[model samples]
Each structure stands twice: as C-alpha cells, then as structure tokens.
Target: MQAEDSTTLEATLADGRRMTLSLPATDAPWAADGLRALRPVPPTHTGRGEEPPTLPEQPALPLEVAILGFGL
Candidate 1:
C-alpha cells in the first residue's frame, strides 16, 4: 500500500513471519533500487513443519569495564 507522500511495503520471510515497512517519499527510491538488486537463493528449510533453529544460551558478561577511567 502507498500513501500520497510515502510508500508502504509488506513482505514475508522464509520463516513464515510477516513484516511491514513504510518509507517517506524522499527515501522511496532506495527501496526500489534494493529490490532491483535482489538475487534469488536456495531456501534454508530442510524439512516440513520443522521449527527454526535457535541459538544456545550464553552466560552474561561481567560488568567490570571502566567508564571515564573509573571502574564500574
């Protein structure tokens, strides 16, 4: 969908998610250029109805960094 002064784009990802983006008229040209530069690639899915892979949990880092020469 498009408004008088802006353009709206709707898209779906390979993971079955939906997204919407709105850009002002001045920046709309970049969106067109980006779309024109897209190249098709093989899909990542390997099985039907399989959930997406997730990252392993990471330990929280120590907050011992110095700020302005003063240790926190």
Candidate 2:
C-alpha cells in the first residue's frame, strides 16, 4: 500500500494513462452531497380517488402429463 503525498488527486485509466481530475475526497461534505445528488428522488405524493385494477395472475403449467390424459 502506498501513502498519498499531497492532497493532489488524479485518476488512472486502464490504458496506463493518467489524467488530472477533480473529485471530492472521502469524508468531505462535498462527497456526501455528491452521493446524495446521485441517489434517485421519490415521486411526490398524490391524492388517491379511484384505485387501478390489478392484472390477473397467469396459471402455471401442469407437471403431471398422465393426469392431463394426453395421448403418448
């Protein structure tokens, strides 16, 4: 493990290329804010009147072939 010298930070690519990037360091308030921004926001609550109809469930295939009386 290597220790970081200065507060300077950069990102490394898989192609052995290094790029100077600006990113919020861990434990920083900006990092927490960034993560919170990335999270999905919940939809706003609405007044309910008529309920929507639910779809019918599909029947599963029978495992007993002989019980179904199918000709071999």
Candidate 3:
C-alpha cells in the first residue's frame, strides 16, 4: 500500500466561487474501482392531486482533477 500524503488544491469555479480541497499526493493515475453509483431518491411532500413533472435527462458533466505539486 502507498503511504498516505496530503496536498492542498485551490480553484475558482465557473460561478466565481473559490474552493479548496485536501487530497492524497501521488504520481499514479487515479482509479474509480472503489466508487459506487448513487441511488435515486423518491419525491417528498406531494399534494393529494399534484404530480411532479418528468424531468428531461441531462448528460453527465466531465470530471475535472488537479494534481499540482504531487509528492513531498
């Protein structure tokens, strides 16, 4: 197993929000094998006769990753 390391990353989102993240420092390509898909949630607080309108399916946005200053 690789030794755990910490690194800080800062970025400005498209909506002008600044965000920071702390992640493990490594030179290897990241993997998604440990990730699991999320389940859908049922609607809440519906009226006796009101029905929620069906939403159009939207394409998933590509993930963005930053790997600044990897390794100690």
lDDT of each: 0.54, 0.51, 0.45
Candidate 2 vs. truth: CA RMSD? Answer: 16.3
Scanning candidate 2 in windows of ten residues, the lowest lDDT window is 1-10
Give lDDT tens digits, candidate 1, residues 9-71.
556776788766654444555566533343346778766886789989988655553353464
Per-residue lDDT tens digits for candidate 3, residues 14-71, read: 5698766555445555523211121234567555886789999987654432233343
Candidate achieving higher lDDT, 1 or 3: 1
Q: Give the residue spans of candidate 1 off by over 4 A.
A: 1-6, 27-72
The lowest-lDDT stretch of 10 consecutive residues in candidate 1 is 1-10
Q: Write down the RMSD of all candidates, one decimal each.
A: 8.9, 16.3, 23.6
Report the CA-based lDDT of candidate 3 relative to the real structure. Answer: 0.45
In candidate 1, which residue pairs get closer than 3 Å at backbone N, Cα or C atoms, i.e. clash?
A: none
Q: Cα deviation in Å at residue 11, candidate 1?
A: 0.5
Show where candidate 2 strays beyond 4 Å.
1-7, 23-72
Error of 1 at 45 (Å): 14
> For each candidate, what TM-score against the reference?
0.32, 0.21, 0.26
Give candidate 1's root-mean-square deviation (CA, Å): 8.9
Q: Please say which candidate is ahead in TM-score: 1 or 3.
A: 1
lDDT for 13 (candidate 3): 60
